[model samples]
Every structure is written in structure tokens, then in C-alpha cells.
Target: MATFIIEGGHQLKGSIQPQGAKNEALQILCAVLLTPETVTIHNIPDIIDVNKLISLLEKLGVKIHKIGSGSYTFKADEVNMKYLESPEFKEDGKGLRGSIMIVGPLLARFGKGYIPKPGGDKIGRRRLDTHFEGFINLGAKFRYNREDHFYGVEADRLKGAYMLLDEASVTGTANIVMAAVLAEGTTTIYNAACEPYLQQLCKMLNRMGAKISGVGSNMLRIEGVDSLGGTDHKMLPDMIEIGSWIGLAAMTKSELTIKNVSWDDLGQIPDVFRKLGITIERKGEDIYIPAHKEGYEIQSYIDGSILTVADAPWPGFTPDLLSIVLVIATQARGAVLVHQKMFESRLFFVDKLIDMGAKIILCDPHRATVIGHDFKSSLKATTMTSPDIRAGVSLLIAALSAKGSSTIHNIEQIDRGYERIDERLRAIGAKITRVN
Candidate 1:
């Protein structure tokens, strides 16, 4: 495994651009299978999970071409349908959680789709019931192989119907929308996830001849079309990465400019950090975070109660950035409560921060109360291992602000999300190195 050796207490400068959204790339890449025409996609981030999904599509007979640094063209003119049932496919499909999305387009156009039990971060239990249940509601037959732990859906032709989702899952909503776009009649989905990722998918499908309305709302209506065509699409900047950079600047006491952040879509992220007493300035589309040398103070509610930061659906604070928020709070001027409602195991990483002399109380699997050191005490560096992507980046930020050098093992988890992170940090005056 590769590791990162970081020398702490160094301030970073220069501007960094966020990569294309990883979540959106997964959904957009799967949508390419809906048409035989060339679908050109720009701003594709070069990361592990996204690349794995592209390779999986290539093996299934989708013709892929590199157009530029972060651009690609894909055509699904001659997909290998039989490959879905092959042993090689089972092994490949199980490697990425995003691979489950391909089933939607395949079942829509070809009438059959199969996938192995998908694998991803071990933060918590992520059920596939929403995806399968949505397909069943659209007149598809669902079956599971308990011995092999595989899922399959098939139908001669799907007929549209109304569905009220038990939860507003982003991926689940995206999968169902893709299938319903080619069904026999109109489909209405209430309680849908309206995140920017899903909005981009719906807009792209409309350009491809699918009829969809309610682009940025919880209720989505789709009028099925006979077939979809191809179109060009550009993904939005990753908001999660932008939030990480903001937290990094505050923790390390640096002046960092995050370029081309698409501010209008960053709902609630800036205000949440500002509530932590960090200064965030808007310069056109970029976000400028000034050095917090005196340290930041947490804000209390109007009633003078302690502040609580929690995650909810879109237009709410994202759960993915809670780790970053938690890490930065260790050095703030006051206390704050961080509630990670989406995943149970995400807060388990706090023990590592506690080892570095930060004051934190693990309330439960879903909550933690952090008492800020207020920069009067610097964290002492130590050796650690990365458990997941968000947690890995959070640990890296902690090491960067510590007093001495720190070593982090299993950095591959970080690479799965961020593109060339160490190299990017080095450009911004950060003393970080990689070891094989």
C-alpha cells in the first residue's frame, strides 16, 4: 500500500480548482448507454472509482475515446448483452457501487439487466431495495440469487406508474428516472432527490429526447419517449471537494482561493462554514478563505444554545463534508455538535484525532461534541491508517495542521475521490510526499 508523509505547521497559498463531480460522473456515464449515438462528456475527473466504471463500460462493448485532458466520447452502438451474465462481469461489477446504475439504462433499452452485490465504502449499510423496488413498480420482474448474492431485472416492456419513495436517495432516484424515460407512458416520482447531480442527469436526458420536468424539485414527471439520442454534457465542480478546501484553509491558517466553484449550486455550504466563524469571500465564481491565524469561534443559536451542524437531503448541508467540519472544529474557538445522520461508522475516525490531543466526545455512532483547542494547543503528529475516503482526507487535514510529521497508510482510499491530491497540495506550498 502507498502512504503519505506530511510535515505539519506549513501554510498553503495559490489557487486550486475543484475537479468534476464524482457523483455526477457516475450517473452521466451510465446514461451514455441509453443511446447508440456519440455522447461527449467534458470535465470527467481522473479518479479511481469513476475510471473503474468507465473501464467496466468499455468491457461491455461501449466504444470509448479520449477527446482531451478531461473529456471523453462514448457510443453504445453494439453493447455486449451476454457479457452482463459472464463470470468476468460479476467480478468487475462488484468492485464499484456506481456500477449498479448501468442496470437502469440496460433494462430500459434491452429489457434485461443483472448486477452482482456492489461494493463501496464500509461507512454503513447501503441497501439496494430502493433501486430494485422502483424497477418493480415500473412493471419489471425482480429476482435475486441468494447463493451468488446477485440481482436481476427483466421485462418485455415497462409501463410507467406513480411512486412515492420511502427515502429521497440520490442514486436510487437517478436510476429510476433513467428507466422511466423509456417506459410506455408517463411516470411520476415524488420524494425524489433534487441534488445538482440528479438535476444534471435530467437535463442531459432532455437534450437526448427524454421528456422530464421538475428539474430542481422533489417531484419529477417523465413522459416516456420511444428512443433517446446523444448529446454533449459538462459536469459541475465537486461541491464536496470545495468544502474540503475551505476547511483545509481554516485549519492550516492559510489564504486559499478555490476557483470556479459554481457558487449558486453550493447551497448552505458557505453559510455552514461561516457559522463556524470562518471568513468566506466571494470573488466572481471563486471562493476566497482568508487565514484564520487568531482562530475561529463557533456561533450559538438565538436562544444561546450550542450550535449543531447536521446533514439532510439536497439544499441542506451534505454529510460527506461532516468529517472535514469535525476536523476543523478541533482548532476553533468554541464548541459545536456534529450530527452525521446518514452513516453510522463515519464518526468512528474521531479516536484518531483524540490520539493527537484534540478534545472530542463521541456521543454515539451518529453524533460527536467537539471542544475546540482554539489553537492554544497544537496537535502532535502520529501514525495512522485511513479507513475510508472522507475520513482519510479529514486525517490528512489534521496531519497538515499538527506540530510534527505524520504518516498515513492506505492512502488509496483518498485517491479514489481526489485527483492527484499530494501533487496538488505540493503546488500550494504544502510539505507532502508519497511513498510506495
Candidate 2:
């Protein structure tokens, strides 16, 4: 129950550093269950989701030490419990979507895992078919109660096998990889979601002694080991948040320097944003965004005049940022279509933007056409509530660029990606304040 009240129409100055990827942090935390040794994770974001996952781990008998600021040492040397199906554990676990990833790991290491229906954002239908299907492939038995919405899992020493996931799910891949690392034999996963988050999971596992090949590809091979050892790993920067900041800087005409961004891992984001006429400069590992950037119009291909940014499995524009990009396109010099094919109902938030006087055509559940308004901060400000992570950030950008002061409630949605966003924006001269 916190709200951000913002006074808009300010050319922001100064610099901001992106937080550690929350998505990656959750997966790495779940990987700790794979070993009985101490695993030190650095650059952990102090977001609610990470805190929830850490709370879950502590409940399961993991010993967590506060080594330093933004770092922790987690030792789950004695995993006293494998089943969590009560109302308390259910309420806590249901608060975040990333908890579902524990299913595969718990089944691989412990023989059984009890998970209730996991919840996160209210974007659309969050499916777990790929996750449960992968676990089934690895010899785990699963049962779901429709009335109770409880999903239970059980497996005995998961045997290695090949699984061709129906879709490239990021968490699904992480879950399967965590399970296969300790299985009896080799496991080959094809059409896997190879996002940087999953890459960090694999790297952390390998550091703990799991033999994993093809770190950033659709195909992954994991050679099951007897046990994983203790290791230290630092999570990568939040590329989605970085992209959001880049969009914010361009729209609001701000100059910013984002520190500790893993440039090597941001494979297609720069080029993709460049297609929309935003230029980014990399000074070593940090990214510099200039002021009043002339964000370009969408470029069309040789085949057609329409340019579309769609979400694929990975190595494509992330589905998580489609809403943000759509919002950014509202101020660009041209019209671009964003197709969120992965989730059918993700485009529902566009109506709120349309209400804010932006031009948008909701073609269907999967497609939307956004026409840039080139709107200067107007004199009118409105009250808005966040829907999901990407839309929430996009709305925050809108509020920051709007004419007057506005209020955005339920900002915890935005906090999932952007760490201490109000504070970070304040550093860059954004007039934002968080209030109870």
C-alpha cells in the first residue's frame, strides 16, 4: 500500500545504476537447494520477490547470512523439509511466480514437493504446462486439484532424459536444469528459454559442480553429478530495467549513466532499441544515455512498410517489455505495431494509455498499433494504477513525462523490476515521491 506521487516535465540529470536482475536472483536462490554447501550470491536486489524467496528458503531450513550490503551467504546444508502445502506456506509462496521453479529441484533432490497455485502479476494466463511437463519427462509425478488449486509433485531419483518443451519457458528451463543436474544420467533440453536469467542459473549450478553445456542456446545438456558444492556468484544486471531506463531517458530528455550493466549479455536490446531510433553508448561496462535524444521512427523491412516488435522465446524482444516499448513508441516519430504473441491478454493495459490521450489501436488480444503523439508534458494529470511489471514501469515513465503531478498506486508491481525506482529517479532529477 504505497503510492508514488510525481510532478512531471523535468529534464532529469545525473546517473543511475540498474539493480541485479530479480528474475535471475530467484532462479539462483532456488538453485541453492541443489547443494548442501554454502552458496554466496552477490548483487541481490532488495525487492519483495527476492525477499519472499529468501523467506521461503529460510522456512525450509536454509541458513542465510548477511555478508554485506546487497550480498548474502546461503547454506542449505540441512534441508529439513521438502513438502510445503499449508495455508501459511501457500500464502507466502503464492505471492510470487518464481516459487514454482522449486518443483523440479525439490523433486530431484528431495523426492517430493508440494506447491500451491503460484501467483505473481495479473497480466494474463500464466501457464505452468512447460514446467510440469518437463518434470513429468524427468520421471516426476504431478497432481493438481482444480477446486483447491494445489499442485503436488513426487519423483524418485529423476532419471536423465531428453525433453522437447512445448514452448521455451524461462522458469521452466531453470526448473528442469536444476532437476537434471542431480539426476542419474544425462539430460538434454531442446527449445529451452536461454535468457540471461537462465544463463545465470546454469553458471551457478556449474560453479556448484553441475556439468552443463550450451549455456545460452536453445539446446542444453546437463550431466548429472552426485552433489553440488558451494560457490559464489554475482547476478547480472536487469536488462529489462535497463531498457526501461533508456526509454525513460529518451522520452524525458534526460542524460544518465547506468552502472554495472553486463554489456556482453545484452545481446539484441541495443540493436532492437536502435531500430526505434534510440542510440546508446557503452563506456566500459556502464551505459551512457544522452539528453534530449532524438529517438528515431520505426524502420520498415524490405517486405512491408509496417514494423512490429514481437516477443519470441528469447533472443527476441522480451515479452516483459513489450508494454514499455509500446508506451515508448507513443512518443516516437512514427507508428509501430507490438505483437505480444506469448500472452494473449497482455495488451489490456493499452486502454489506460489511450485514456491518457495517446493514440493506440488494439488490433486484438495479441496485437496493438501505437502512433506517437510527440506530446509535450500537458497540464492535465490523472490517477493511474499499475497492472503488471512492464506496464507499471511504462506508466511510471508516462507520469514522469506528463504535465502535472499524478499518483500511481500499487507500485509494488513496478518494484519487481526497478529497484528503489523513486530513489534512483530522484538521483537523476526526477520529481517523484513515495508516500503511504
Q: Candidate 2: which pairs clash? A: 277-296
| TM-score, cand. 1 | 0.99
Tens-place lDDT digits, model 1, residues 296-381 = 99999999999999999998899999999999999998999999999999999999999999999999999999999999999989
lDDT for position 10 in model 1: 93
Which regions of candidate 2 fall more than 4 Å away from where they truly are?
Answer: 293-295, 376-380
Write down the lDDT of every candidate, Cα atoms only.
Answer: 0.96, 0.84
Model 2: how far residue 117 lies from native, Å? 0.6
**Measured by TM-score, how close is model 2 to the native structure?**
0.96
Runs of candidate 1 with Cα error greater than 4 angstroms are none
Consecutive 10-residue window with the lowest summed lDDT within model 1: 288-297
Model 1 C-alpha lDDT versus the unseen true structure: 0.96
